[model samples]
Target chain A: MTVTTPRGFRAAGVAAGLKSSGKPDVALVVNDGPSDVAAAVFTTNRCKANPVLWSEQVMADRSARAVVLNSGGANCYTGPAGFQTTHASAELVAQQLGFGAIDVVVCSTGLIGETLDRDALNAGIEAAAAKLSADGGVSAAEAIMTTDTHSKQVVREGRGYTIGGMAKGAGMLAPALATMLVVVTTDAAIDAETADRALRTATRETFDRLDSDGCMSTNDTVLLMCSGASGETPDADEFTSLLTEACHDLAQQLLRDAEGSEHDIEIQVVNAATEDDALVVGRAIARSNLFKTAVYGKDPNWGRILAAVGTTDAVFEPSALDVAFNGVWICRGGEPGEPRDTVDLSGREVTVTVDLKAGRQSATIWTNDLTHAYVHENSAYST
Target chain B: MTVTTPRGFRAAGVAAGLKSSGKPDVALVVNDGPSDVAAAVFTTNRCKANPVLWSEQVMADRSARAVVLNSGGANCYTGPAGFQTTHASAELVAQQLGFGAIDVVVCSTGLIGETLDRDALNAGIEAAAAKLSADGGVSAAEAIMTTDTHSKQVVREGRGYTIGGMAKGAGMLAPALATMLVVVTTDAAIDAETADRALRTATRETFDRLDSDGCMSTNDTVLLMCSGASGETPDADEFTSLLTEACHDLAQQLLRDAEGSEHDIEIQVVNAATEDDALVVGRAIARSNLFKTAVYGKDPNWGRILAAVGTTDAVFEPSALDVAFNGVWICRGGEPGEPRDTVDLSGREVTVTVDLKAGRQSATIWTNDLTHAYVHENSAYST
Candidate 1:
């Protein structure tokens, strides 16, 4: 998924050999045109990784010349040395491309704390710069994945404009702004402030709402760059809509790739007094281990749902609450609703709806069920 | 344990056939004390269980004439009727024992949201009254367990008195308190206010520090009922010391009984700016699934510990942190420590020390590891 593959801006992805597997691990996407608009959202974790730290400082400037990502190291908890290594990494790419270091954004994913191979990193930077092309976006997407089973790339074209993005995360990963590193390049001309506003708004409804394992990571980042190469700038409202659609596509891809996930479980909260209440209730159910376990076992356990919701501070009359699993109301008003035998759970996607019946607010959170494979995979691997 | 087993009271554990396993499920304890002395602590979960609601309200009277507990059904989220069931249950026990209804406290645990069988419960009440004995603590203890592998009970003899208690929880039960129901009976005399203060302080060091699974329960309650029958009214200070010791013993037992737990992990966060910061750091590590998984595998993965701590807003510099897993300094100043082979994790308990070069405050949280058996046990059973 390249910017030029969409409509106006050209994109590129290349094999920079940053990973020990000799896989394409370094990716760079450059926006070419007069209007070089950009915005970014980094992880909210206080103890951010080196790449995130660098991107955070640069994101304040509201413009990005390049997005440089490596797949084999997270560069977290490596102390001051890690930050310097990250800075040098960006410098390698920026100097090669004749761009300032500060205009370049950096990202990494893999084992944390270990020092990166400076020579290999610099070599990869040279290769990436030389391999840069509008058609390299797909290769760039493949280079950023760590445990993800597949590459996630999406492109949607509109009237003389385009939105294309690539994301990578198998979701032991959590982020306040986004789950993983997603770079969305657009030929749709938009202001940096508009991109930031639309990205934040779309993210809360998209990436942020997907709560795979509830374990927030230190290196999650999402960068959006806009180039006016299309020579056609749309209204801010249209750009926001296009951004939302792109975010929705990437969000779906992240959920689909959640590690060891079998069923994609969604908890939809409706009729709450506020979106915060819906989120509180949704998050309460999303983080519930018992509830997740039941879903993994393919059991319509509505009791745990009620119990989890009751644990939250959201005010609601127990008698007015209702819960449904797979469209069948298993519990209503704190009493038995439909029979359990009628509810099916063998599907790949399950929906658990909790109606507050208190007001008119709603939200949705995507998650996965607890499974034996999840335990087997995660228990053996150290964080 | 029951009050009647301690010299001035009668107790009974009878079969209402409430548990699917056909284990004795209904228990009653009565206090025929010449002096009433009592105190209690309820769950911190805002959406409390039915028993929590009843117990908190009754213990506020500073006197408990009787307590009726039924397993196999946690009368929670049963709405107004669930509240009414507790009232009716207490009324039944109170009527049978000729004790005032307000003097009776009620507790129920098992599956959440299930209604109690009032008729069966009433019959068990009569049977328990008939079978009341002065040494029925073990039977009562066994009847209260849900998934606990064994009943936890402890006894300590004091000067001219004794402190005996029983608890039911399998560590995964986070007492928000996790499904905890504790009953401590003593013959020493202490006023209600003194007992409450001592109980709170003791819990803060003991029950409140156990975070095994970090999933807060809505039905946790701890009740202390003193008969004052020994005619040995100790001073406030002496009474508090004995209570504290007894609490320590019981709390340790629960930690050891954590379900599917091969290693009982004790995480101590020390040298902090405040006790609250210590607790925050302790809990962040305690709740980390990756850290717990490493503990289960005996891998001494210290990076997970650093990753977890750094996620918190607590004022601990990454370079100023040191971590010891089972006495092996795996990380110092947020970097690799002395190289050492793996520790023998076959032992029943594991200890982790996270030293923050900050202040003098610290906290300890007891937890179990994430094992394959845990996933199997939880996933196989639906609530």
Candidate 2:
């Protein structure tokens, strides 16, 4: 299941030599809709990519008919020329689809600050438009991958509507409204208001909970397009749940495929004074290099975990905190508990639970361990 | 020249069996002064070691006769027993020197959340006291090291005054007046107010600017003691300059000897709206994992640098930013300039300069590349 699983959507992917590896690097998704309702979230980073800045304008009217993405270079910090490139790409897509240029959305991901191969991208867009089909979702997903080892696609069916989505991100992942490029399609007869509400809520709980490397990207974008192909309209709450589920499914895939990560960690901060406190504390622990490295070593170093949490301004007694790695409690009341060696962390998934014991609120943050592979991949990413 | 280079000070270091390697793990610095005025700064991290908590009280009175330090275990989060251990260590030093226990400062650094070897430290205190000498600064400096490859010592001689200091920190360095354990002994005839003012000002521009791993240490302590042995009083501004020089010398040494780092990086944020803005932007770039990893790979990834600076709330026009690596302008006015491959990073030191063009203020932050060794050493640190 992928973006095309939803009715009234067509997708295509093509290789135009933008990637040195000669892999598919351009993807196109179109909404053949009775209603072109759309919403998008962009990177909070101030240094917005050219495409990001362009897409912001496209989504300002809350309507779009197409999305074009390429994964070879992030046209960020490329000055005026980069913005013009994005504009030209959108106009080209609009011309091929016989739609208004303002309705075409564009997303780009790869190394930042480099000018994209405009000719390759232009040819790829024409090729993708020519091959557009309802079953091209998988190819579209594959084309958006950079360091991702696999394509991420998900679909959820409600009573009379369906939500489908795809995501591509491996590193420079952190939290906000977005982390990477994600496209969701739905045929639920939702309006722009409903789509915006559902997408924001969905991303906050799913994509925004993953802090893989604590690095924010300039090209992060999440777009939601409603084609309204389903004759029966779904309830707002029901549609939101379906969208959230689809996003969560794709987020899990992204976490699993995160580059150079040996362990996918779930940091649960429980019993915090508030939900924000829980999330903040969880994020702090998730971003700690010391804590991540300890997890990579498969060492139940809960001390590093507590030390990380201690850096947060969360409401908790230093002597009342408890930490557990996997299922073994390694720290209780801020002191040593069970023998650390007794805990097993040989698996790919590790759970670190922290009990602040300050209140009943809780939150969970997903992260990847800092490993040699992580260093290697990031260090040589552009090379 | 080190802590003992200043007149009216005696220092010693001895093996305490606290370290598994059986190296010198305990150090003592005494102020044989007509004036025992002192000042200090502790870790800004909320999760402070017991020794830091104890030393804060010692500095509150603005008078101290000695400072005792032991490396191997950071007595943090060890509950009441940890505080007792710190108190006992200070009392032991005071008893050996025949002074008030309240007049003794204590500093501990090593693995966090573990009970230190109290007996070993006590014995080491006795041994160090017996060996105290005017030429024991080097030994004291060597003893305070945890993962440091060498002792960090510096002495700055001024007109009728001299400032000597020693620092030990190989990792978990960040800002807020302190980053590691530093003891500065000055023969300048300065009062307690002068000592406190000079220490804060010096550290703010020196130790506070070194952000090795963005991990703030729980045991970071910087202490300055004035013995008033150089009977000739020096100008307050002149003594501050000398103290700042000594601190900068030690800070540079810490950067060079940072644990597992391959390159020492200097990030200068120029033309900021304020000094604080410059420091924040510099620190943001310095703490970026993607940027650090790119440095380790010897790749001039200016986009990562801009992306990092974008995360801060600094005042700057995104399109007007300029970034240079190793004196080669790779990005000018937010666009590509010189070829990235033209930059050379074959040396141990690398410099990244960013011109924000927001104002006239500027700041520089020192960091280290994120290498495999850094991840490995930190991963297996406790084990």
Candidate 3:
């Protein structure tokens, strides 16, 4: 029954009273043996949450024994009072779990600027500690979610190594709501620098390409910990591959969980003059609300697509352009190709291919369709 | 009673069978003059409408005597067939108005695709020709509106000179949703190059700065025509001032027309490292949906402001930042400064100031708040 994807680690999740829905909202995970070799990436947003700030400093030391995460409140922009609240929360978790306060990472997600009920957080931490078990990974994954309809978790085993991770976010997710927090545990006997490099490279391709509504969050981080329990350590290539698979698996899940989303868009740009130009055009279309909504309504409104790409200063020849939506050639050789009614859009996934017809460079961007659910979830959800 | 602020121009608007609502959706204005002077600019979007493509080529010859505009449909991306439709529309206007087809410019707003009713359009052209008058400017203004609750007309008169214009677009509009088409007529004598330079500079600062929601349309244009009938032309400096005044006036009208737009936002960036950086930062913040919705809710949420700014690579010390929402210093010197609840936000306009505190550079980006009406209008509308 143990769900521990990595050796030398145990985790737990418990009802923290932090979420008004009475759902499990607090999780604690630990590297029980050997040194907890870790490397972390933090959100680049200047307006950071207290947990991010605390974790940023602690992460500079490149090691951690435990991480405590709670959903339902993002203790951010609360100034000195909020930071102290974060410090106290971490201290309480570390004291209960027999880990040093500096070695304990803390995270909170939900409303911003609200004070954390210290009594409730304390009880939650104690309960999580008491409930810690090898089979508690799923419970921990269930706890750290906000506005997400499902849990996002990924596990991989390769080269005598195991990699497991969990993530949470839907909107306020751009390269850097890329404010995603993920916990990756491995017993691969890997070095901290290796883990950091693999994680950054994988994240740049996966999470960084998700431009859902183009809003960056203040509390985003991806923490990877290597317990170094496995005696067999793979080479750089093998280790990087293992970490990338884990990151990719989680990235797809994040796209699937996009709030009230019906369509997942994968925009591929090919034959561009440069990779930079391809991405510029791809992201421009991905960030376009009109284009997303048009696709949502099953309207092959290719004009909006052309209009979006046209706004960019990139060197694209309108006459040389060819565009296809959902495999239907809408625009070819710079003119209308066929009626949109002929385009089949019964699939949940849509592929928009743009041939810049320039010099063969290419890139892809992923996003979700704009829907009423997205607006409702963002506008009405008080959090 | 003469609303024609510019001398020597006969302007009028008449209903064409374009809008199903029975509202006036077509307008025509003639620059009858002792001197025919003209210059124009079109949307930078590469995927342009038929009118824009036709007019850009026409303006290269620097000659246009009368302009016809339709609001019920935008002839964009109709392909070669669409190109023929524009040609037919212009030929009829030219024949009836006693000018060559090259002398007449046509603009269409409303839905895209579908063909124009040729017979109705021909008749509408004749009707507008018969009704053309110097005193008919008001009715002409009324005829050009679509989704705009008011007719935007502005008259700027200086010492022996004048600049008058009519425009359409809601205040909270982005470049995409707002297919801004403006026609300005003046009695001042100026060269085509001068007119083009003045118009480009003025539009860059005035219309381009209004980058709310970052929506760029296929048929955005500003047409300037000089009749030179008053036989009085100002000095170079004086003419520039008159043009600025006219642009300022029209800009106000456009903002006033913004859809269900409750608050007008002016985001001023100062002390940036570079002008480009200033523009990039201002535009980034303006395009941010979360910050926009927060302003709509009157929350004065400064953290969202900082988060938006952080997404840009424009160099700034997060700890050295300062922000004021509606003139209230919410974040001072990079941390929460004072409670912004005391700030008055009931006014129709709001200004957010961000100081990079890096160098001597500043810019102001005008935008509109994200209201429920905006969502409703954009969502419910079929086009």
Model 1, range A262-282, lDDT digits (tens) per residue? 789989999998999999999
**lDDT (tens digit, per residue) of candidate 2 on B1-383:** 89999899999999999988999999999999988999998887777778888888887889999999988888887888999999999999999999988999999877777788889899999999999999999999999887777888888888887889999886443211123889999888888888899899999999999988777677888999999999968888888888888899988988888766789999998999999999999998888888888899998888888888899999998889999998999999988989988999989999999999999999999999999988877777666
Candidate 3 chain B, poorest ten consecutive residues by summed lDDT: B169-178
Name the 10 consecutive residues with the lowest summed lDDT in model 1 chain A: A170-179
- Model 3 in CAPRI terms: which quality? acceptable
The candidate, 1 or 3, that scores higher on TM-score is 1
Best by TM-score: 2
Cα deviation of A214 in candidate 3 (Å)? 0.6
Q: For residues B252-272, could you state the per-residue lDDT of candidate 1 as single tens digits?
A: 888887767788888988898
**Which model is ahead, 1 or 2, in terms of TM-score?**
2
Model 2: per-residue lDDT, tens digit, A134-163?
999999999998877788889899998888
Model 3 scores a TM of: 0.90
TM accuracy, model 1: 0.95
Instruction: Score candidate 1 by lDDT.
Output: 0.78
Better of 2 and 3 by lDDT: 2
- Name the 10 consecutive residues with the lowest summed lDDT in model 2 chain B: B170-179
DockQ for candidate 2, C-alpha atoms: 0.60
- Quantify all predictions' global Cα lDDT against the true fold: 0.78, 0.87, 0.78
